[model samples]
Target: MNRNKKNISILGSTGSVGTQTLEVARSYPEAFNVVCLGANKNTQILEDQILEFQPQAISCDYHKELSTRGEIPEKLMSLSEIATYNGVDTVVVATSGNVALIPTFEAIKKGKNIAIANKETIIMAGEQLTSLAESNSVNLMPIDSEPSAIWQCLRGENNHISKLIITASGGPFRNTPVGYLPNVTPANALQHPTWKMGPKISVDSATMMNKAFEVIEARWLFDVPWENIEVIVHPESIIHSMVEFSDGSTKAQLSYPDMMVPIKHALFFPDRAPKSNTTPFDPNKTKSLTFESLDQDKYPCFEIALKIAKRGGTWPSALSGADEA
Candidate 1:
């Protein structure tokens, strides 16, 4: 590793995005370093990743494993400690659900730059979270695809953006008959048509619940109105997302369906570093791009998400937690 590379701490170190993040850090030896890693129950994958990255610190929900092993590097109690480690510079909140909120808030309070991948934290507590970040002048780089696309285009311009049109791949049920939804088995729901993801997210996608969650996240993340938050079904998944400006112009961010691109970019904002496993995108050779308004009638989950964002306070938190139970 380069002596001058920025130190990074990745929460959720064994999951899909977290694994890709390690691959990016490995690929860019000169630009970044993994100083900390945290996981819940997947200690085996976590064990393998730790042996490779050799992060300065690590954490997991289980402490018995750490007790049994004596050769491991820095191990800590909390995400908050990982975020504010002495030599660590960038904090990546890759953990699932609202569990990331407090630790991410701890990072911001200490003035650490954050590369946020977790959406539940922002979806439920966005108003409070954004206000806290602003109060401290923290640079909250987005690791999610839609927000990153908007941020990339919104840079270096005073031009007003009128609408934030977040695209959805419409998941496995995008085409399953309307009445077929209630009968949608978890087995069918888990099969995402395009992206490879963990079980919770995969299930969320099929029910259109992830897009619903995104609606709320966008509301506070961009400081936009709930009504202005829009979703389009682009089953091809080529057009990751788009933005519409007040001057009648639209900017779109297109890439092949890969989570690593946004993950790497968020960690290395203001500078694009090299990474592996992402398919190179080519617009000319690409097949086709399609878009359509979200069918609220077919997908009531999306509508409930929008309504929760508009209503404000506790409801969004309740729904997300209910999913966990």
Candidate 2:
């Protein structure tokens, strides 16, 4: 297959995932270009990135910019603008919270490839986003590890996926003795043993709300039935997710905990651009992998998300909006 040099933009360009994504692009400078960048409010990093990649556009919520007097990129502004940039062939939606909801639609309507790292957007507006994507024939690649695994399994196979099994690290409270949960501090919750992410996401991981949000996202993103999706507590973070077929066979995607794998998959699918660093999975480094059922008493957010997904209306909007507030 002939590979085209793709132009890329990243939403939440200052976040952990976004920085790593830029690292991936730098790894393969010949295959990809950073066409645009969006961030909450961090002009220093944004300026540094702009100096490095020289994206055609940039967007900061206007809050993170310490020095507003500097020369800003002419195309820098709102997400809708980044999504529709003429040079933006792929839009990496790495922004946190619900902001990804509308931009996902905007990028897809323009038929731009969307590397979706935001779960709230789908939890809040899955049906609307996917419908728009379908109408416009866009690729909504799941940058989240688990969903990416599912996408890989479904590629060019007779994949009648019977069940979607999501693996979890069980968060900071995995062994915190249930009694200590009520006393869990924000500091303690911020300490995720497996993944390095933003504070809001780390907090959500501690509560298992992140997994719940993924469940809702998978349902709408792939048009899978609710019951087909299942969650398991895998203390070892190696197995991102699994898929069980109608033939009683199961397939899973595993790697050392890193967001770059999925991000790269989204950016260059049907082909892989050479990476600057090679971090292959080593089972010898990891001991045993265990799976267990989630204790509902421990995570009510899971049930609440399930309810919202079933209701299938603007209720998700209320949930996402209320949580954002």
Candidate 3:
């Protein structure tokens, strides 16, 4: 193991964000070392990732299947345990849903810099986690594209931010009539235009609930008030997010819609590496950019998430559970 390389443990190595984090790690082999990996119930994918990254510690919800792999610890650790494992210097919280909160908190408590892909973790316990990270003197980095965009826009701005404008793709049902919401089947909701994502998130996108969660996430990640955070439907997803300063000027982060861009940004903070697989924004290709306000009636989940965010405490936990169910 290279002494200088960042020793990382991924909490959700089998998921979309986890795989992309690995891709970023794969692109810069000398910069990062995979010290640990965890997965939920995807034993097959977990097994495959183990053969590749070869982490010293492993955690899977299914302990029996993981025991078959001699490389993984026979006494498999839980997500929270692997998160604060001694060898890991950075912990990437990529697990979806409320399950990520505990491990993310545990990692922060241990003073491990965190790259968080799971928005639910922030939505549920952003205040507590941010406070924990501050006390522990560790970084809690956002991996979601919108929050990352807000983060990028706020760079060196001297905390003069007046408002954070988060962008939304408006999802597949953007054009569907409000009267037809009840008719929306799972398959209908899953047809996302710009990004390929998992089913639950796909549904959330269709409902604009994903954007709402981001609103709460931005609130905690940037320590901005609820009124200071806003969302607009930008069907193209070219502009990830925007920030307005007290000086009355707004700056937005634009890139070709790619998760790897933000992933790389969080992994290597305050410094940018050359793009490996991500495409740079081309003005010639992007002729027009449009933004619109979200209709409250069409997307009730957005309102629900915001309501939960404002309520604070364990309300977000309930919101996450309701969304998952």
Candidate 2 lDDT (Cα, whole model)? 0.81
Among all candidates shown, the one with the greatest TM-score: 3
lDDT of 1 by residue, 1-325 (tens): 3459988889888888888888888788788888889898888888888778887888888745654344577466587788887777788888998778889989888888888889888877888888888899887888888788777777776258688888898888888789777887889988999988889989888878888877777778778787776889998887767778898998888888877878877887777765456777887886678787778778887777666667777887887786666
Error of 1 at 29 (Å): 1.0
lDDT of 3 by residue, 136-240 (tens): 999888888898988888778738878889999889988989998888899998899999999999988988888888898888888999988888899999999
- Backbone Cα, N, C clashes tallied per candidate: 0, 1, 0
Order of quality (lDDT)? 3, 2, 1
Cα deviation of 137, candidate 1, in Å: 1.8
Question: TM-score for every candidate vs. truth?
Answer: 0.94, 0.93, 0.95
Candidate closer to the true structure by lDDT (higher is better), 1 or 3: 3
The alpha-carbon deviation from the true structure for residue 267 of candidate 1, after best TM-score superposition, in angstroms, is 1.1
Tens digit per residue, CA lDDT, model 2, 130-248: 88887887888888888898888777773577999888888988877777678879999999989987788888888887898888888888778998899999988888888889999
